[model samples]
Target: MHDFCFAIPYGLILMTGGVLGYAKKGSTASLAGGLGTGFLLLLAGFLSLKAFKKGRNSYLAMILETGKPVFGYRGMVYAQSS
Candidate 1:
């Protein structure tokens, strides 16, 4: 289940590139476009995953340090007065 979360995007990008590559008349431009799109998608996915992990770690640390949840589903946090 967790693995699929990562695998799905790669699979979709590969399939999309394949389709685009095939649609073009075997020209260099088509191949280039497909490869470029695939590369950019991969790069974006990698960066997003890294950011998500970092954010989750930061949120967890904040919760531990503050001894309270940082935000609710509604994106509101209660402030405590010292």
Candidate 2:
């Protein structure tokens, strides 16, 4: 129902995946992508959650969540190119 509801878990998953990837394969890319995007998602989630509590919406959170797909797509494209 709310962006924060999903974003928080998704962020945590990404962060965990990244750490695991690095640990298993020593992939800096995975670590960077996971931690970086995960942090952003987490931040956005919290921001939106905070705003929701105040009966307001956070455009920043919306923007970040909306843009995540694009960023992930780009990451895939970049990985393929390399």
Best by TM-score: 2
**All candidates: TM-score:** 0.42, 0.93
Candidate 1 ranges with C-alpha deviation above 4 Å: 1-25, 56-82
lDDT of each: 0.47, 0.95
For 25-53, candidate 2 gives per-residue lDDT tens digits of 99998999899999999999999999999
Query: Judged by lDDT against the true structure, how good is candidate 1?
Result: 0.47
Worst 10 residues of 2 by lDDT: 66-75
